[model samples]
Structure formats: C-alpha cells, structure tokens
Target chain A: MSKAEIKSPLPGMFYRRPSPDSAPFKNDGDSVSAADVIGVVEVMKSFHEVTAGIDGKAIRFLVDDADAVMAGQALAEVEA
Target chain B: MVVRVLNPGLSTTVQDLGRPGYFHLGIPIGGAMDRLALRAANLIVGNDEGAAGLEAVFVGPQLEFTRDALIAVTGADMPIKLDGEEKPSWTALKVRAGQVLSFGFLQTGARIYIAIAGGIDVPLALGSRSTYPIGALGGFKGRAIAKDDELPVGNAAGGREGRSIPEALRRRPGMPAELRVLPGLYWHRVTEETHRNFFDDQWKVAPEADRMGYRFRGGRPLQFVERDQPFGAGSDPSNIVDSCYPYGSIQVPGGTEPIILHRDAVSGGGYFMVGTVVSADMDLIGQLQPNTPTRFVKVDMDGALKARADRAALLDRIRSVFA
Candidate 1:
C-alpha cells in the first residue's frame, strides 16, 4: 500500500511542537500510532492539532517549524 | 420537461446542496443559500437531496413548461402564478404542459427555491451541481439564467409518481431577517462592551450584499487594539496562516463593515472573524436582501450544537417522509 501523506487542511504556520522548548513529536523514521499528534496548526489565535492516523512512521518532514503554509499543502509523509 | 426562460431574474442558477472538500483549491462552497427549502422541494418530488434545482433571487423569470412536470416552491413567499392565477407557497403542485410559471414581488425573504421533480438536468462539476459564478465552473456555463435560455430537465420520473409531501416537512413563512451567531474566533479581541454592542445594535443589510458576502450597515465598527496591521491566513498573533474557512464566518476586515461570508464566499481570507453564524441559523442569513434590518443574537456553543442537532433531526424527518 502507498504511504499516506498528510497535508494541512488550512493555511497557517506549521509548528514541530506545541510550544517552543518542547521536543518534537516524531523524528525521522519515528513510528507513530493512530491519533498521534504529529503537529499543530496555528491560525490567528486558534491552534488545531494535526494527527497521524492508522499508525505509521515519519518518512519525511515536508514543512519546517514556523514556516507559513497554505491550505492543502502537504506537511509530512507517513509509511505504514 | 423543459422550461423557457422569459427572464432570468437576478442571478438565477442551478444549485445542489453545496460543493464540499474543494476549499483546499480555493473553491467557495456555492449552492442554494436556503438548503432547507431546496431539500424540501426536492423531497416533495422524490428527488435526491443532491438534485439540481433553480435558485431564484428576489424575483424569478416567466417561463412556460413545455411538458407536464411536478414542482414545489419554497423559501420566500414570491407571488407565483400557474398561468396568471396566484399560487400557494411551500407546497407541491402539478404544472401541465404549456403552463407559464411567472413570479411577482417577494412578500418575505430574498431568495425563492424552485425544485422540479426530475431535477434541473445539469452536469455535475467537482462533485456538485452548484453554481460558482466567481470561478465560472458549475451550473449552466457557470452563470445565471438568461432570457430565451432553454433549460433541460432530467428525463423520466416526471410523471411516474405523484406523492403527497407530508405537512411535517413544510415550513412556515419566514421573516425578513433573523440570524443566530456563535462568538467568532476573535470574539475576545474586542472589548466586552464592544461585544455587548454587537448583538445589542440593529444592523441593516447593505445593498452591496451578494452571493459572495453580505455587507451590513448600522452596527458600529468593531474596534481592536491596533487600527491596521498585517493579517495572514491564520488568525494567530504571530503568523498569518491560511486555513479552510467554512460557511458563515463573519469576516471583519480592518474594522470595516461586517461582511458575513455566505455560500459563494472565497475559500480563505485575511481578516479577523468576529464570529460565525451557527449552522442552524445559516438559512436566516440566506434570506436577507438589500435594506433588510437584521439583529445578531449571540448563541452559546451548547445552544448552537443543540440547534444544529434539532435542524438535522428536522431534515431527517422530512427525508423519512418518502422512505
């Protein structure tokens, strides 16, 4: 099966961790379970959590922390 | 059945429920502003909820039915005639071949929904039949109905079943304006006094309103700490991020006139959202025309959720009538 690539549903800045000084959720090739918080999407003042579903390993990070992203922009690739 | 357009009215077009899952492509979810009336008319004629129908605004065109068909009129109480005789509202009626369907002035509400039994035969675009005039992608050439235009109807099922629409599915005559809103993402940005002033004041629907957004007058400009600043896609304090904005988001641009984003609004925007018109009260916004005075009442999250659930149940009840 093809790996599921996760993308941001809205435009906003991408954050590796919920806040600064915190460790990232996953590094390269880090295995993650379904519903794992992959990242956070902050728009205006609202912060929405982006989760990795159905268990997968982070194969690549397509977006950097604090980088502005548009809606539907792919953020990460996950391999089951 | 076929209907010849004597007049197109104001921006009339075929529409379905709406176009979802395309906001990522900057596509606005264009469709019938009054989904309740649209679905009700469709259900009356045994059409699917997603069936294409005519969305007429303010006044509709004079058309002659070329073939016998079943139709229902709902939403605004537009003076309609089955060949010059006045007809009732929110009820299904049979129109014989050659009967001219003409509409008079609107008594209440701005939009009037006309759902044909076989459904307005129109090709689907991006998984929907809604008309997005901005993108010129859906409906008949992605524009409003015009004079002398011949509209095609989905063949068959026009004369097969003549079913009676249950009374429970019928809605009473609607008022000019009454919208319920949930506090927006930036509701707290304005002072509590300003927030109080929002619902307390009466706002008139500006003449500049359209499918894209409804500009309102009378309400004081919502003040913020800074007069002007760079706003990004997201409402975050640091970075302006772009996000898929759903329908009913009240976009306040630089403390300008409050523009209530409607069905044909842009996918994403750069502005401060004061609040959103809750899902239950979306149709109320749809019916507001130029110069209509409307008041915004703040609804709590729980109340908003309950209202949405109630509306869903009501539609479910209407859908079950045929089942």
Candidate 2:
C-alpha cells in the first residue's frame, strides 16, 4: 500500500471534529473515500473542511486538535 | 449570462461603489468594505470601476457559471478553485458553463471580491447596487445571497483574459495596518489621557465587528468630561443629541471600546464620535481580521488629501497597465 499525506490548504487552527461536542470526523485506522472530510481549519471564526482527495485508511494526525497550522502543512497521513 | 449560487459562504452580498448624496435622507452609504479591491476586480474584468460584484466575507461562495464568462477574484487571500482546480486571484480567467467556482480556507484578510466580465445585474436602489441589509435596500433582493439564487449578468464590456495585476498593487494580508484618523466632532468629550492612549496603544479588533461597524478593545476606558446633559442628549456619557454620522466615524459607547463605523453603518446615532477614519484608509479597515492589532494615526486634512491623491496615483498606474 502506498501512503498519502493530506495537507492543509490554508493557515488556521486545525480541529479533528466539527465542533467541541462532536465525534472526530475519522479515527486512526478508519477508512475514508475521496472527498470525505477529515478535519476542519478554523480561521477568522469561519470553519473550512479539509477533505481527502484519495481513498485511504486514516493514519495518525500530524497535529493535535486545536493546534495552529500553516498553509500547506501536512495534517494527516493516509495509507492507500 | 447567469450565475447560480451553490453555496453562500458566510455573508455574500452584491456591492458597488455605493450611493453618495443620500446620507441626509437617513440612508447609509453602504458599499464595498474594500473599495480598492472591488475596483481591481472590475478593472480585471473590463467593467466600470463601480460595477456590482460579490463581496464574500471570511469564506467565499460556491458559484456555478451558467455560461462561458470571464471573471476575476480580488481582495483577501482566500484560495479559490474552479471545477476543483486551484486558480490565482487578482487576475482574469475564463470559465466554462457548469464550472463550479469555490473557495478554500482563508489565508489572510477578511473579504474577497469576485467580478464578472459583466457586472451582476440587479435592480439599483438610490443609484447604486450596494446592499444595506439593515434597511433591506439594494443589491440582490436587498439581502445577502442565498443558495440556488440565479443572478443575471449584464453585457460584458470585453476585458482581456489572463491579465494580472502588478504585485506591488496588491494589499498583502497579515501586515500591520495604520489607519489615519481625523479627530473632530466630540473629540473634546474624551480626556487628554484617553486621547494619548488611543493613539499610542495598539487596539485589538473585537469579535463583534461586522458590516455595520468594527468594535475595538484595548487600553484604559476613555472617560468623558463631566457636564450637564443637554436637552435630547441621553444620560449616558457617550450619548449626544442624535446626529448624522459620517462614514468611518469612530464612536465609543460607555467609553470602553471604540467602534469605527464602516460602509454599512447607520446614518445617524447618539453615540459620541471622537474621530473619522480618513477616506484613503477605509479600505484598510476592511482587510482587518478579528483579533488583529491596529493603531490609529492622527493626520491633518492636508495629510488626508495627500494620502487620497497618492492612492489615486497608484490606481492610475494600475489602469495604465491594462490600457
């Protein structure tokens, strides 16, 4: 299996779940399809979803939940 | 041509230069928060300087073109994509029918301006297409656009595709901004110590900011000079006889936080205004993001006019590029 990395498109605070009370979009080892939302980046109080472009099994997230991330920073690794 | 709104990200509204000469009638001069960006977008698409366009805040909208048309996105560093392919901003590009134009996470700044070859064809109110949602007047049905709203496009003026603005002309985000203010009208209400604090200290933008006004927080609370309340002036120290408010007026209620009224602010209010943001720097206010630190620089009328002239010269230089 080839590994792929999902990168953040913009700089913001990364979140594993949609909100504070919600479950994470995907857990480690979970399977995801193309276009499946993996996380969200909150900027200027607006939230934008980060989606997977390739189907794969979720690996570990590169950043912790609520950590500040920069544009093009790798968020998570996926095993295709 | 027609454009369909697939997703109205945040508050997307159609705005132009705005209608002047109507403030006396109790109508606010609601228009584009960043007029410089709006003009740049229009210039890229070969439209009039004041042509109507979409002002997307923080997030941008998902727009599907119904026909082939030329478009340009300016202001804010929000990444834009067409048909799922990333595209550059501050440049004109051609879009085919059924192509979806969407945005990525905001990189910097707060709003993005999207201009088509032909401006958004909406019924003009008071000689402008700008939206004033408080009064529910002008723009697309006088409100922010909704998903699935089909907006008609006017005739294209024919601008060259692939035209890009010079790098120096673009306003980079994340840079500290200094907005020039002309202190006047009720300036005497605040104590001298507060006046010094207002100019010397950095003020952080509060989250309560919006199209109506940008409220800032920082420094010691300003105190008004004790005086007997005049007739029709409320008891609050910040309150005065309800009067006309010029665009960019800064009013402090309870003297705790200062609110700089913007393009869509109310025409008249009882709040005490200590200063008016100069016309040239109003665009800078639009680019300010929440929690960003800013400083108000005091400038005289001559300085303000000079700044305005300098901006005009810069715009002229940009126009020469396209000409």
Candidate 3:
C-alpha cells in the first residue's frame, strides 16, 4: 500500500473531533482506511464529513482543529 | 452543431445548477437565477438537470443554428422566433442549420432560460458549468455572451418526440409584491418596532438592482437592543458583525431599507439579517425588475418546509414524465 493524503473539499473551519474537548478522531500513528471519517468542515453551523480517500495510518495532522481551511486544502498525511 | 449570436440579449451567459459546498471559501453560488426554469428547459431536450444553458435577461439574443438541433425555452415571456417564424415556448423544437432564432420584447418577467438538447460545451470551473461573472471564472470564457460569438452545442440526443407543458402549469407569473420571509439569525437584533415596520411596509426595488443583490427603497431603520448589540454604541454603532449569508438573505443596514441578496451575492455580510425569502419563492425574486414594488409576508418554519416539500413533489412528477 502507499501513503495517502486527506484533503478538505470545501473551504471552512476544520474540527479534529466532534466538538471541543472531545478526543480527536485520529491522532499520529492511528490506522485508518478510505471509509474512515477523519474530521469535519463546518460552515454556517452546517458540518460536512471529510472522509479519508485511501487506507493508511495517521502519520501527520497538517491542519489544527478549528483552523480555517481553503478549498482543496490539505488536512492530513497517512502512510498505508 | 453551431449557433451564431446576433445580439447578446440582456446579460446572456451559460449557467447550470451552480457550484455548491464551496461557500466557506467565499465562493458565491453564481448559477441560473431561475433553477426550475433551467431544469425544465433542459429536460424538454433530454439534457441532464445540471447541464449548462443560456440564461437571458428580459430579452434574448438572435441565434442562428448551424445544425438541426432540439431546443426549449422557459421562464420569461420573451417572444421567440426561428427563421422568422413564430416559435412556441415550453416545448422542444427542431431547427434546421440555416434557420435563425430571435426573441421579441419581453412583456413580463425579467429573465428567460434557453436549454439545448445536449447542453452547452462551456468549460466547468470549481466542479460546475455555471457562470460566476464577478470572479471572472466559468461559462463562455467567464463573461456575458457577446455579438458574433459562436457556441458549440453538446452532442447529447433528445429523449422522445415532442412534449407539451401542462395547461395549469403554464403560469403567467404576476408582478410579485413584498416577498414573504422568515426571520434569520440576526432578526432579533433589531428593535420590535423596526421588525414590525419591516413586515408592514412595502418596498420598491432600487434601480441599481442586479443579479448580485437587489437594493430596496422605503423600509424602516433597525434599532438594536443594548444587550443584543454585540458592539456597544461605538463611534460607528451601525456596523454589525459579519454573518454567513445564504441566498435570499435580507440584510438591513442602519435599519433604513432591506437588501435582498440573490444568486451572485457576496458570501458574507455585516448587516442585521431581518429575514430570508423562502427557497421555493426565490424564483419569483429573480423575475422582479427595477422599480417593482414587493411585499414581505412572514411565514413560520413549518410553512416553509411545506412549500419546499410541495415543490419537490411537483419536480418529481415532472421528472417521471420521462420514465
């Protein structure tokens, strides 16, 4: 398998976990797959799920939670 | 197939359902002003619901088809002609290569949509074929149709022989008055008197109105409750916090008049959002021309949902006709 990178489809604030104080959906060294829901992109109180496109392990979280992200902005990198 | 533009009618451009899911990046959904009409026209000629077509305002350009192709027109009542022969609207017609298509003066409504069989071959931007004129992106080179410009027709084929619009469905849309609206997130920021005035008064559309937004005249000024005023009475107390604006959001700056934002509107605003005209009724708003008087009636959330549901059912019925 090859390393995979996850990206946000829309520009919005990224949330690592469901809400503040909640455990992050994935952290470094976590194993994941294409079906995993890595996080969310929230706009105007509406949240959209950001799913991983490839099966891999969470190697790096490129964007911090609640950070504003642009369209096609990179969110994380994973090693499959 | 080729089509020649004789005169680019009032602000003609290729548009579709629009590019959504990118509003957070400050991209406005600059699609067709009348989505239902766009879809209806496309369906008549067997085009996908999201296929790109021509969005004409008030009057339409004189187009001469260079191939025998199927096309349909809907929305406005702009008289249509092919090869100097009067053409019927809301129905598909096959035009020969040498025939010319033209539009007469519009008697009612401001915009009309012309959908060809296979859709237009405009390049897609941000995952859509809709035109976003302000950003200089999408559509035919991301600009309005110009004289002598030739557009390539899509190669998609028509579905069936011919179809007619239901008699009852053929509506001569009346001049819309104040648009009914539901309170938005910032509705409570204004004083009670101001809120009442908004519902009670009639607003005249400003001449400066465009696809971006419509500025209305003759409305009340907003007064914020001291507690509701996030920013205390600073030197510029009129300034409000910027809020995410969906299409049809009415913003009241200084509570004087209301500005109804439509397709091509800015992503966010810093005004008291008094209300949002329901989605179903949004198509009517697109037809309102400058100086038109409109009334705003308030409806509950339930009513809004019911209207949406009704619209969905109507569309579903129309779609089933092809099944």
Better of 1 and 3 by lDDT: 3
Please list the residue runs of candidate 1 whose C-alpha ends up more than 4 Å from where it truly belongs after superposition: A1-80, B156-176, B226-244
Error of 2 at B247 (Å): 0.5
lDDT of 3: 0.77
Ranked by TM-score, the better of candidates 2 and 3 is 2
Worst 10 residues of 1 chain B by lDDT: B232-241
Q: Alpha carbon lDDT of residue A64, candidate 3?
A: 90
Judged by TM-score, which candidate is best?
2
> Candidate 2 chain B: minimum summed lDDT over ten consecutive residues — where?
B170-179
RMSD, candidate 2, Å: 4.4
DockQ comparisons of all candidates to the true complex? 0.01, 0.15, 0.01
Return the lDDT, model 3, position B201.
76
Return the top candidate by DockQ.
Answer: 2
Error of 1 at B78 (Å): 0.9
Q: Using TM-score, rank the candidates from best to worst.
A: 2, 3, 1
CA lDDT of A73 in candidate 1?
A: 69
| Candidates, ranked, lDDT | 2, 3, 1
Cα RMSDs, all models = 20.8, 4.4, 19.5
TM-score of chain B of 1: 0.90
